[model samples]
Target: MTSLYDADGQALACTVIQAGPCVVTQLRTEEKDGYKAVQLAYGEKKEKNTTKPMLGHFKAAGTTPKRKVVEFKYFAREFELGKTLTIGDVFAEGDFVDVVGKVKGRGFQGVVKRHGFGGVGGQTHGQHNRARHPGSIGACSFPSRVFKGLRMAGRMGGNRVTIQNLRVLKIIPEQNLLVISGSVPGAKESFVIIEK
Candidate 1:
């Protein structure tokens, strides 16, 4: 994330993203695959690291093995196999887009950090070492067992998250980079899908 100055000299915080130079690896149609979607491959990978079948797949597309391949449904644009797509081809400045990515994993976490619980409130009235405890999990014997889907201390983050309607602050077509307003999901160098 970085700050940029506008025409009015106001600093705006934004995140710089390396958008893409994605290649069209495969196309799915209603008749052939019972769906309409485009499979795009991005990022380069060594051929040895890729499986034999995937190697054949990339061979069919006339491209090298890619680190990431994703299918986007309802893609209206017509593209030929082995075509490369850059950021400028799909988006313009000021366009609103949705970014989908996985959030950073926090591993095991307490309720206070995970669910924003108040943490027993200030250690008052003989409350010792119970600040971050999830109070009162269940009743004495009414339900008998712990309920399903209870919000407690457990694994946090590392989930697929989408940030919608983020304004496109700027576009650097030459470098295939995009500057978007506000923060996006995932850690640095993580792959994300940007949708119109």
Candidate 2:
């Protein structure tokens, strides 16, 4: 999707994705499996990338190579085994969906960079090396142990994030595209799961 904003200067068209014609590999029911679910396989990968167990699984389904497989819980009752469920089947324009994906990894960041902590001494009395430092970490003999979740410097990002209730602006079934009205997590071409 384009990164350009709308007429009102809000983010516009940030999540235009070419979604699925994913194959239904497995069907789960409440009686036998103790829950309801439908497993979907999408994105064909090379034979080399597939493992022996995965290849056997695909072979049992009488289908081709797939890169990603995921399960959807509490699915509708109308689904069946070996059904080729496409993006056109579930989603439509004006429908609300949730996009779940992993965020970009930024390893080993500082407190000001990672946790949005205001650092010490943009201007201070006789401060030399205190810029961007997490100052005053403790009280004087009152609470000597630093409090938990105090926004210290650490690893950042690369976490699973879900953007909820994003409106589907358009659906191009021919192109397998889903144009959503807001931002989704992860980078371009990364695997993301969209659910109603």
Which candidate gets the maximum TM-score versus the true structure?
Answer: 1
lDDT of 2 by residue, 1-196 (tens): 6654556887666578878888887777789999888888998888898999888888777678788899999775667666777778988788999999999989999989987878886666887887888887775687767778777889999999999999887788997998888789998889999989
Q: Judged by lDDT against the true structure, how good is candidate 2?
A: 0.84
Clashing pairs in 2: none
Give the per-residue Cα lDDT of candidate 1 at 131.
82
| Model 1: per-residue Cα lDDT over 135-193, one tens digit each | 88875688788889999999999999999999999999999999999899999999999
Clashes of 1: 0
- Alpha carbon lDDT of each predicted model: 0.93, 0.84
Q: Residue 193 in candidate 2 has what lDDT?
A: 93
